[model samples]
Target: MGIFDVRKIDCHAHVLDPLRFPYAQGAAYRPSGQEIGTTDQFVEVLQCYGTEHVLLVQPNSGYGPDNSCMLDAIRRYPGIFKGVAIASLDADLSHLRDLRDQGIVGIALNPTFYGNDFYADSPALMEKLAELDMFVQIQVQHDQLLMFKPWIERIAVRVLIDHCGRPTPEQGLAQPGFSALLDLAETGRVHVKLSGYAKFAKTPYPFRDTLPFVRALVEAFGLDHCMWASDWPYLRAADRQDYGPLLKLLDTLFPDPADRDILLWQTPKRLFGFGA
Candidate 1:
């Protein structure tokens, strides 16, 4: 069977229906034009791609801490979507439990967008997440992974690293941040998303410069600990990105059908409780 005909899980994407749920006050960036992926649009697009499940992440742009848009999508489409929210650093445990009940499976932190200092006090929230069996999804660039070195294991939660650590392709594989992410694989508690190559690739899509980094991640984390993501709507994107072409890249990356199954289906099902 072809890739699309096989069961696949998009472990990361977003639901930005600003028309129904307006952007938050002082929201950092406003996603306009092609960046807007309404809940309905997301469902229709994924349906066309035969993606059976998705994890909708809250974007810092337009929605900020107001996870109403994402939460609303989860509620509206019951089983099809799960969420990674953006509750503040020291959010209350009870509030987290409420979010969990509302289909939020984790928290999303963007050190790349807000910087390390903004998340300095995150350990408290980290501890709470572990207590509740929720994960923390982080987006960082360059050496920023080093900043989380101290806290990641201490809290002992399932950590999802976004966009291949958003590494600098010019830095080669040894760049400290990406290297730190590689090392975390040994801990058996970290997972990496193989998406967003366009976000950090100095070269354009197909993002050939990022190929070496992805191979290294797959080698280090293993296909069992790594999964596929689309960063749908390609928000804040450097170039135009769409679902089919991005999904088709899987064949090039993993020529073996067994390996493709592991990345696109097995890992997400095991890690995030996706699919039947």
Candidate 2:
């Protein structure tokens, strides 16, 4: 069977359906009519690419902490989906425990939209997450990575940096921010998602310009610490990007079958607790 035929899990994707689960009043942005805005539509797209499992991230479009849509999808799909939710910084332990029971394995922190202080102020909540053995998924601009170093050092929960830390080609690998991310990986508790290449890619398609940074991450973190993802629906490039090409890029980048297997299957299976 081809690599694409393997039971791969997309470690990051968003599910949005404004019709049934309307966007929050204070949402950051609303999904356009053209976007794939429902769980069934999102699943159909994943099916077209041969993906069976997905990690559904609560979209910023639902600005508030309500994750009804994401939780419902996990309930509907059972083993086929897991989720990362966005909760209020002041959310009590009871709310968190309830989220855990609902199959949420992680909490997402996006400093870019919510401001850096949200995460900095939530150490207690972070501790609760660690106690629950849940992961903390962070999305921050590259330059802001250094500011987050202290949190990384103190938090005991597993950290999953989104979009390869969203570094730019102009910053290169040695920049202090990107360098800080590399340093975090050495701690062994941190994992990096090989998603959103299109966000940082200075070139088209295969996004070769971003390869060096990816190679550096794999080197620093090793195969076990790396995981593959498709930021599906491609959001900005919904009409342009297809899921198949992203999977094909992995085959090209990690030519060794063993290494490719880790990126495509093994690492995500372990990190996301797939089949566990």
Candidate 3:
């Protein structure tokens, strides 16, 4: 089967419908024009690509601690969507449980937005996530992963690192943060997203610079622990990145259908409990 024809899931994407859900009062960066990806538009993208399901990740760009938009989409599309919400640092246990009950499988902690110190209390939040069986999704760049390493080491929460830890491509895989990300795989509690090449790739298109790291991540984390994602709507994209090319990249990275099966379907379903 063709790559697009193959069964798959969009492991990372967002829903930004300002018409229905207005941006939060104090939202730092409001997505506009091409950046806006409404729930209906996203559903169409999935349909066009023959994607089976998707994980609706709440970007830190808008809609503060409120997850009404994502939660509402989950309710509207049960069995086909899962959410990774953004909760405040002091999110109480009950509130978390409520989110989980309503189809939120995890929470997003974006260091790119607040920097490392923003996650100072992450360890405690991680403990709660562990108890509730939710993944702690982290987005960091360069040496930022190192800031949370000590905390991650102390906690046993299931970790989902975004954008292959958003590594520095020129630095190679041995860079401290990316290296630490590779090391986390050994703990058997961490998973990394094999997407977001545009976020760090020095070049465009095929993103050749990121292939070596992708190889390293697949080798270290194995196929089951590494899943595919498309930072869809190509938000804040440096160049003209799109959804099709993102999936096509997998063909170059993984020639075998079986391996794609694991990365595109099984791994995400296993980790996020999609369709459950």
Error of 2 at 79 (Å): 1.7
Which segments of model 1 are wrong by more than 4 Å?
none
Regions more than 4 Å wrong, model 3: none
Query: Where is model 2 poorest over a 10-residue stretch in terms of lDDT?
Result: 232-241
RMSD, every candidate, angstroms = 1.0, 1.7, 1.0
Per-residue error at 21 for model 2, in Å? Answer: 0.9
Report the C-alpha displacement of residue 178, candidate 1, in angstroms: 0.9
Name the candidate that leads on lDDT: 1
User: Which of the predicted structures, 1 or 2, would earn the higher lDDT when compared with the native?
Assistant: 1
Taking all chains together, each candidate's TM-score versus the true structure is: 0.98, 0.94, 0.98
Give a tens-digit lDDT track for model 1, residues 112-219. 999999998888888899899999899999999898987996778878999999999999999998889998998898999999989999987788999999999999
lDDT of 2 by residue, 1-276 (tens): 576777778988887777778878866677765655578887787777778788888877553577988888999987789999998777777888888888888888888667777677767777888888888888877687787777778878888899888887887889887899999876789999988888878788888888999999999999899888888666656247777888888877888888877877788888878788
**In order, what lDDT does every prediction score?**
0.90, 0.82, 0.88
Ranking by lDDT, best first?
Answer: 1, 3, 2
After TM-score superposition, the amount by which residue 228's alpha carbon in candidate 1 deviates from its true location, in angstroms, is: 0.3
Model 2 lDDT vs. the true structure? 0.82
Q: What TM-score, to 2 decimals, does candidate 3 have?
A: 0.98
Model 3 clashing residue pairs (backbone): none
Worst 10 residues of 1 by lDDT: 267-276
